[model samples]
Target: MAAVTWSRARCWCPSLLQVFRLPVAKLYLGRPTMRASQQDFENAMNQVKLLKKDPGNEVKLRLYALYKQATEGPCNMPKPGVFDFVNKAKWDAWNALGSLPKETARQNYVDLVSSLSSSSEASSQGKRGADEKAQESKGILVTSEDGITKITFNRPTKKNAITFQMYQDIILALKNASTDNTVIAVFTGTGDYYCSGNDLTNFTSATGGIEEAASKGAVVLREFVNSFIDFPKPLVAVVNGPAVGISVTLLGLFDAVYASDRATFHTPFSHLGQSPEACSSYTFPKMMGSAKAAEMLLFGKKLTAREAWAQGLVTEVFPESTFETEVWTRLKTYAKLPPNAMRISKELIRKNEKEKLHAVNAEECTTLQAQWLSEECINAIMSFVSRKPKL
Candidate 1:
């Protein structure tokens, strides 16, 4: 969800607020002091499901509001029309919360569930959180600490190749982070390889052939890229190992990128017979000169961490032995500063490019969707897939 804007939310709120006689101050009062810990979240959500009796409409509405706020951030959707009574009630319940921080809502959800489950034994209550549904994340693992929300690509066995589902999961993670005031920044990293880009097998195994893949891929890719473009908080990338394809191109969007000496960046868009996604077409040339951008995007040159740093593509390249510790120490220190200052600074620097980036993303997606169905792209993929691996 996008950050809640007073301008947008107020479109339907003036008369509604008057009708409810709810002072604006009421919305700000009585919020939980802190976010629910991971364990608290898991325990509360467990009890949320185990309640023997249906918590009536009022409580159910409260639950729905809290859950949405917790998982998706502020209520940014348009207010339901008066004629849509059911949805209006639901929307009103959520909108009433009024800019409550996601973390606070999470703790409130936990408190509400705990209060509801007081009659039951702890052992008998459920112990699941919505997040635990993915026992082993196919690729992405999301965690939060202090003010940093880390979205790690965890499929080291597969060189952290991205799947369609992984893209969706990442989009969701970014959305959740964007609205959470506690989340000062998003840190992306991988344990082994940063990412090898899309797993071809994920596309090949689709129900239909390249046509179906292209159509679906276009939609998902656009959504994923837009999530990055619209991300409200700082985005930081820690490149632990080599990155390929979109992984490298995406560094253009990050507020800061720290890489290990061992890390390298590569983009094989031309080799794949496809064009860029994620607005790299715009951001790349602006960050690095057009010549360097052409070398990476058009000529498919690999860039070592030090080389990328010299070209202004990477923020810093640390020694491999202390990369993680050094990068995180810097991040934690930055995370401690006043968040609004950084946010405003970032906006001032990049705000002018926002619309152009969106336009470039649209053009790229259109070209890419068309390219996906081209004979050249299909033949190139097939040729790459058919080659035998070195023993």
Candidate 2:
């Protein structure tokens, strides 16, 4: 009789509670193993249900969700205070806690806990879609306006450097926009900077690994760029200042490129001890001729927007005051055209560029993923993060 009772308890107990040996152990208020005071747990669950109507706070949901995961029993478990909860667990030791026996229920609880925590944290961010929508419509925005979307790189505070989550947001936004016919043309950057380039601060946490920080940005950045280049609608770029690193190369692929006379461009490939990105190696030369393109890529020369225009890279240079209105008028003109007409013509021009961009992005991801995990990249990032200005 004693052996049979012990075996039943072993099969029923949750791993978190199995360590406890009855009498002295503390008990949580919510659990499946109870009878006389089970209504307490039911009351707690009911309270949680009421809170659901006001999910604006979300605290109750988070607590209930955690409790549900911590226990391996029917969600309609009993509530026991610390002393009484322990007594209930010991009392119900011989009974299976959930419908799927015990082990299966425990596994579900563990998995549910992990997922709910992550999701609840993400939810705390609150209506991310709405934030993006507001950004797209206001201040200065990047747009093909219809079927083509734009993500303006704002934040001159950090020299227009992008944050890591910002990178992820752009990627996800572009992906979401890709499916919508309302988006076709995509542009980037705003204010006085085209992009002071990737916010170097995010390099350390890059998903591909560490040593390859530069490569990861170049690789991830290329994906962000190609969404537009290969887009069925024309991609336009309006530059105002240094189009550094990835920014410098991406512009070469734009269907239309405009810059302010104050706009400048450079690629710090050599400064970072990295190689060139995109097919900037191939397309830059093809677009601007070998001699001129090499001058910019090889030297990382800081070319003024007017200089880039002269070299056949930029389409035109506009004054700062009029640049926004001029680009908007141009883009909206295209947006108003028969959508299919614009897409078909765009397809013909980008067909070959699409193939090249694909191959480059794959190779780039591999090369950069390796570099992100390297020591030099680690120190470079840490130093940059810690450094105060050398007065």
Candidate 3:
């Protein structure tokens, strides 16, 4: 359970944050400095059982001891009188595995326990207010005398849902315009949505299935985010209607994101039974707390423009009626700036934010890739692809 702890140890988040808990037994066995993620630990756990299977034997027992020593401090600092039956059972079971070097394992366990500091324990139940899905979208297009470069995902037919070709087009257009001295600033997204990100069906099929596609998507989106993270010139995105999943996540990497009043926002990954990509792991939590970010990432809930604004995650929102006009007007502001200044500013800001962004992208990729290879994730993808579209 390197990347994650056991679900049992994990706080069951009916809503909001689910605390991450580790089973006291064998918790300390892995390299603590490294976040093994849930699947990493599970894979190793399974392997241990396979190769070192002794029911109530030494491998399992040593694992248990390691877990106890590692988590000893985190579990409310191990009270002498509060020792419970579960601990006793784990101890008994652990005893079956011969004790090796307790001190050496202790350090590793402590490291594993420290990793959970990044995990939040708060829940919606304890909060004073509650809200569900909220979202917004707008179109950012610039068609002035300078140069014409429009990026629109506002295809009304599919609610502006993106196709694979659309992403390729975006990359191509951005790269081209950014490189072309003739073009000053690039316009992005249009209509009800700048984009709704990937077409899940096409994505699933193209990658052969969700499990296979997830890893691939993670890698691709990481690169995609990097492209926008620091384009030479200014970029203005018009987000209209609802922008969910990768659409919302990627927007965070943009310099300026504008949306309509009715433009809702969300990362629908969890609802879709998927993990987040597009470097959201670091961005989300850094902008929002672990609890808030986890709510979006773990639950796939949508949020309103006002809600996003409050969190400072969104810059501005316009009414639906004037969304298009507002988007262009807002973009014109950036277009008005000295093109060279805008370019340098974008680059400078990105350099400042680079480390954390890369760290998050790296973490998201690691877990996403590992999860893609799991039976649970693979099975889920098969089931999803086999199902008919909802009416």
Candidate 4:
């Protein structure tokens, strides 16, 4: 197996700086020289797996560098090529640590993790008194009932536009569901949109230049799609309304996609000067003929629910009035199936194509990172952001 890159581990540290309200520079400069017990370091490593929020790219890079120095003593690997922006950035981050002693690096890593854990606990405690409704309204709402784990997009007001935090949340939700007692996992959104896809704010709010932003975004995206590709149980999508961009593209990975009559599927990658993601590049062409896939992905053709069903992108279309009732009724039956049998069957079906999907995901993300830094993509995103938001 290949060594896991920092990008693969990027999902581990969530909301460290934000929870503590600390500047990235200050966090590092103020690091205490106090030694931490090896047991403490091991415990911190375990705590990292439980983190559920994104702490920003700079913080992620710092954590990666410190972890590398602590474990491997130094960055001895050869630098990646320039076009391999994700690995290149990670390599540079680890290499920049110079000759820091392993013990000091371990102590620093432990301290950083401790601070993040403390701040997260403090923030949660503070929010415990806030309105429960408000808390539930933001981010993801994951519920497991009747052996079905339902992950809903709770940000209806924004048309379920996925922020960085939401992406991490969804990944965590799926991770938990995969090992749980659920027979199936479902995804849906609230309000008028199923999902409008990646929030442009994820790009705009990044502190570094486009290169850095694109690199980090690529890392997140690769892991996000991998969650779907590696999902063990039956994965279903209940398309309540309009779905665009990544949301539309990713439906190709779902075991079943039930759409409301009012739902629309669109992947306007070309308009944004981007390419297909979520393994759509391969899955679309495989499901629908190459011509139809090119029409939707390259020509930006939006499909109605019926049209999507006709093209095999959607399994079925339901009347808007009964969409939820009808879909869940069927899903409840699906949830009652023998869990082990279902998982084994799913694995057998996906096994042959799993390697292919992973390859395509990696390729798409790499291409997207380069596109994101291109003048064409930059101008397109700027123009779109400047205009009124629409689905």
Alpha-carbon TM-score of each model against the true structure: 0.67, 0.57, 0.57, 0.67
What is the lDDT for 71 in model 1? 74
Residue-level lDDT tens digits of model 3 in 1-391:
1222234222321111111221222222332344444444444434332321121222233455555433342233333333453444344333422343444455543443333222133322211121111001222222234443555564666656665555555555555455344334443454545556566665456647655566666666665666665455656556666776778887667666777777777776654556887777777887888888888888866788878777767788788888778667656555556554555456556655765676777777777777766676666656755783331
Candidate 2 lDDT over 4-123, as tens digits, reads: 232332233232233232321111212334232334333443333322122211122223333443354444545445665433443333222223333333333333233233344464
Candidate 3 regions exceeding 4 Å error are 1-148, 182-191, 207-215, 382-391
Which candidate number would show the highest TM-score if scored against the true structure?
A: 1
Which lDDT tens digits does candidate 4 get at residues 1-391? Answer: 2233434454444222112111111112123457777897788777776655544454565676777877897889998896765566566666656677777887888876665564556756633432233235467788879999898888888889999777777877776676556789999998899999888877777888777889999999998998899887899999999999999999999999999999999999999999999999999999999999999999999999999999999999999999899999999999998775676577668766877998999999999999999998998888888994575
Two-way TM-score contest, 1 vs 4, winner: 1
* lDDT at residue 43 of model 1 (Cα atoms): 72
lDDT order of candidates, top first: 4, 1, 2, 3
> How much lDDT does candidate 1 score?
0.71
Tell me the whole-model lDDT of each prediction, alpha carbons only. Answer: 0.71, 0.54, 0.53, 0.78
Query: Scored by Cα lDDT, where does model 3 land?
Result: 0.53
Cand. 2 TM to true fold: 0.57
Q: Candidate 3: lDDT of 34?
A: 44
